[model samples]
Structures are given as structure tokens and as C-alpha cells.
Target: MILGFGMDVVEIARMARILAGPPARAERFLARVFTPAERAYCDARQDRAGRYAARFAAKEAAVKALGAPAGVRWSELEVIRAEGAPSLTLAGAAAAAGARLGVARVFLTITHDAGVAAAAVILEGAQR
Candidate 1:
């Protein structure tokens, strides 16, 4: 059963600007919002801004789909690379939200093109 669904889009240029701002400020934002592995993956790519923006959109979509409660930190919704596709892992408050909603599976899709990045999330509830 489907629990919820959500989608989000972000401007790559805007994300680029955010990531390219004052060193200390940008670092703080990145460290606060993204996990260490996520930062490493995006930083190693040529389309760094696009990767970061896609991940950000994915997080936003996941949060929306989960109907997560307040205090759900950005880093708690991590985009993970799998063999076939990318997936999301919830932690802390995010996990609690999924459990509260009985979400058993999550479907995620992300893309970047034409100066924009977008993501969609589908929350599947556990079967009885």
C-alpha cells in the first residue's frame, strides 16, 4: 500500500552558489546538512552542484513523503547509491516518522538537467 508521495526540484545554479560561498559558511552548511559520505561523493564528481542539489531535492521529497515531524535533521535523510538505483535511508526523527506511518519501503528517483535537479519519493506501507 502507498503511504504518501512527494516530489521536489531545485536550481543547480542556486545550489552552486550556496556551495561556493564563504569557505566557513559553506563548509558549515554542508557539514550540517549532508553526511560525510554524501559530501565525499558529490565533491568527487564534476557535476558537484548538480549532485548536491539532487540529493537536497531527494531529502526534501523524502521528508514530504514521510510527513516527518519537526526536528528531522537534513542529514537524517541520506541518499545512498545502490547497484541499480539510488535509495534513501532514514535515521533519527526521520526513521520515527516512517515507523509511525508504517512505511515498509521507499522508492526514489532523481535527475539533473537543464540547470535543474529534481527528485521524487514514494512511501510504501507495510502489508498486513
Candidate 2:
């Protein structure tokens, strides 16, 4: 059965501006919103815009999938990769939503091309 769902899109140019303006801001934003592995992956990229746009889309998709605000204190939902496959980690409001929806796992996919980035998320619950 379906537990939750989310989708998002982001402009590559907007993400590029944010990354260019301040080094520390990017660091802070990444720390608050991304997992360690996600940060590492994004950091390793030469094209920061692509990474930032992908991350922005992922966060928005996670929130939408949760169907409720992720508590403010926790990092927003994060998307990472393992063995080149996508995975998820929820925090704060996102985590609460997952629990409320009886979700045991979240599945996500992301893509980007030209100046656009997009993502979709799906939450799967444990068998009843």
C-alpha cells in the first residue's frame, strides 16, 4: 500500500546564485538539510548548480510526501545515494509524518537537465 508521496522542481539558476553568494551559507544550509553522504557527494561536484538544484528539489519533494511540516528543529528530509541508488533519511516534521503514516521506508528518484531539476518521493510502510 502507498504510505506517502511527494514531488518538486527547482530552477538551476536560482540554486547557482545561492551557492555563489556565500560559502558559509551553503555549508550551513547543507548541514541543516542534507545527510553526510549527500553533502559529500554534492561537495565533490564541480558544477555546484546541478547539485544544489537537485538537493532543493529533493527537500521539497520529501516535505510534500510527508504531507505535513517537518519539525523545524530537525534537518529537512534528505536524499542520498548508496551504491549509486537513491535513498532517504527523514528528520523533524518529515520523520513525524512518516511515523503517523506508518511508513517504514522511503523511496526517491531525482533528475536534472539543462536548467531544471526535479524529484519524486514515495513512502512505503511496513506490512500490516
Local distance difference test values of all predictions, in order: 0.94, 0.77
- Give the Å error, residue 77, model 2: 2.0
Candidate 2 on 1-128: residue-level lDDT in tens? 77778899999988788777798997787677667777788878887678768877877887777775536333556676668767778776667778888988888888899889998888889887
Structure candidate 2, residue pairs in collision: 5-65, 70-93, 70-94, 71-93
Instruction: Tell how far residue 29 is off in model 2, in angstroms.
Output: 3.2
On lDDT, the leading prediction is 1
lDDT over C-alpha atoms for residue 19 of model 1: 86
What lDDT tens digits, residue by residue, belong to model 1 across residues 1-128?
Answer: 99999899999999999988999999999999999999998999999999999999999999899875798999999999859899999999999999999999999999999999999999999787
lDDT of 2 at 9: 95
State the number of backbone clashes in model 1: 0
Q: By TM-score, how accurate is candidate 2?
A: 0.84
